[model samples]
Target: MRKVFLFIVLVAISMASYSQKRYENNYVSVVVPNGWVVQNKGDNGLGTELMSFYNDEYDANIYNFGMIIGFNQFQKPEFLLETQMNLKSSNPLFEKATFGKMYNSSFMGKSVKATDFKTQIFDETFKGTAYAFNEGGCTVLAVGSYKVGTKSDLPQIWRTVKWKNIRKDTHVYDSFREEIEAYCAATNKTLKQTPIVSNGERYVSVYLEPDANIITNTYKFVDMEKSSFDENKIEQIKQNLRPILLNILKATAKNAEIAAREMKEGYIFKYTYIDKNDEFLFSVKLTPDDYQ
Candidate 1:
């Protein structure tokens, strides 16, 4: 009877020791098994390391997991994925690694792009997987690595991650884009690219440009195959499109007032016309004086 009681106590203690605990930062939260240490490394250019965990007992065995949340540049999953893959491939340690096919999978309630890799390092086989996803203008990446034939809790750990809604301000570029898109849709004009807001300046592009029939508002593309247009022709095209571009600026002024006010000073707007190949044909600039 005493042996049975002792066995029951031992089982309960083991289960308690393996239980998980929640860890979180400003951007994300995740559950990790007990005895694992979590570290947060704030803002490393590429992204913010929200949480990274490793068990001291398995540290020598190469067992670990990390999650990063990115907002400044490389916010797209495809771009992030490419950058990560390139970094790994360039590392001398993973020179002979075999990367697996990329696929879409659901993790932490979001669709993610993921891939697996295997490499041999100093007679020890290492296996790893990476995942990326974009949410609310931020990209999140989760990676896990372990030595082959070793036990790993990464899969169970990542499945319990939850993203926090922490972005309080919308990007000014998004506002400019929305207003420009609405104006383009109303005017039956097609935009060549999304509006870009950088360094207190906004740039927009359209598919058509003013030609010889500028008086009639008839737009066409220049023959780039022949040769690039001369300086005189380029200047003339810019002059012809000036009024039309100004009108677009005026039309979106009310909607973009909030973004402009945020800039406070030195706000410039540029509209460019591009060819089918996305080559720049001509462009016009509107200063605060022109838009106000």
Candidate 2:
């Protein structure tokens, strides 16, 4: 019994060490909270790839400290500012008057343009910071926001951020092109929206059709890694995320059904939606890393 107890303790320690390590990519790296979920790590609709990270312990419906990073090719400071402003424009509570002056700053040892912005959504006003800079022929932008009455934890995240010069030829979205193209074909839509990978606490959403909302947006996520998929992990994903299908379709009167298929790498989870007239509207597939 004592030997078994020691072995269990060792296993716990090993998992903890793995969970506490920093996540690194070709362009940037950040130390997130141990066991925090990473959502999208690839292409997003902004014509660039995005990496978003958030903790899962917080309720998904509540506002929590999160970070988003985007990479573009050598956009001018003015252009980057305009792009950032456009993002703020989408939020009804973003007060243009509260936008602070653009200023010079440094991030990860590189010169950057910085701005402070305020957004009032619902019953709360959020204070946020944004940074844009050119690094290794690519432009990197980082944005973080926190609700009022809550101290922003983004500063430490920013301080811990490390960047690497990315090559111009690196294809961030190439691996998933075939899957994305097929998804577009099925939806009867042209491949226009750039997909992005974002990390979340419990899932990663790869936007196959970001512009399409309410009725047409198509995306997918799975709970297994490319290296391998485990039965236990698959069951965990099904148990935790099976409700996602209904939650997404809750606002619509359309009927939806989930289909599962087993593959060599892992299982595929597809959500098919049909309109009131029993006509197919759209379908999105959540496959393992094989489709990523």
Candidate 3:
């Protein structure tokens, strides 16, 4: 217990000093798992290694994901919480015994709150820790850990990491979002009002809400769906003035029949059926020339 507490305090106090990347001047800088993609970096120009981080196995059960001691192969890390706990329990030098825990929490000195997560895997268990320590300056360490089969895995894991220079984390570009936007633009889709999405909803979504003279390829994730539109109304609506939609369908669409439906409000064209296979929007097109 005392040794674990001492380690936590030591990490919290931070003997070594560092700052986040420049762009992260205000936002807290977080060290992410090595294989996770980092699209952008800080304010200063930094080497790709210093500027971004990514992980190969996003679903891999990674723990004790330490910067100063990260394993390269990622197949199996050397350090295991159980080994440390067992060591402390058996070692005569240590006075008290406690769970394998070394925790330090701070909010990049801004006084925000973020909790750590811990999970048990297979025969071994692990604890994930994330906290900012404001020692010389505020620094954040995000940890993920796993269990090792034997004591032999530890030394090699520690030695493989080039911990001599632990550089500040960075993100270089908005690759993911940028790609999404480009695809939507090419397809004439628009983004929804809010950037954040509901769980189970499209993590990233575009909309196809069309305007009077233009087809909106903007998308709304199904997670955000409400009772606004019914099958009756949907069946009644047709693909119209969004000029872009015509372009998109030009390649695959074999044929289309345009017609008009009389309503108390007004007359509208419906693209009723298309292609010999019955793949189309409405019964007619809303163009006046096609009404006759």
Cα lDDT listed for each candidate: 0.52, 0.48, 0.28
Q: On residues 1-292, what C-alpha lDDT tens digit does candidate 3 reach at each position?
A: 3323323322222122132222112222344433332333222211111122223223343233232211111111112322223333221112132343443333223332233444443334444333322222223222333344322222333233221222333233365333323334522221222132222222133222243321122223343233444557555543333343344233112211110112211333232322223233233343333322
Candidate 2 lDDT (Cα, 0 to 1): 0.48
Candidate 3 CA-lDDT value: 0.28
Clashing pairs in 1: none
Q: Write the per-residue lDDT of candidate 1 for residues 1-292, one digit (tens) a residue.
A: 3312321221111112245688676568878777665555443322344455655423344444344443432245655665556544323233456778788987678899988888775467778877788766566777676777887767778788778875533443355434333333422321121222322222333322222111111133533421467779888867877887677545444333423442344355555555435565665666667766
Q: Which whole-number lDDT from 0 to 100 does residue 215 have in model 3?
A: 18
* Regions of candidate 2 where Cα sits further than 4 Å from its true position: 1-18, 44-47, 60-64, 87-98, 170-292
Off by more than 4 A, model 1: 1-20, 44-47, 57-60, 72-74, 89-97, 120-123, 166-292
- The TM-score measured for candidate 2 stands at 0.47
Superposed by TM-score, candidate 3 places the C-alpha of residue 219 at a distance from the truth, in angstroms, of 6.5
Rank order by lDDT, top first? Answer: 1, 2, 3
Give lDDT: candidate 3, residue 106.
39
Error of 2 at 3 (Å): 44
State which candidate has the highest TM-score. Answer: 2
The C-alpha TM-scores of every prediction are: 0.46, 0.47, 0.24
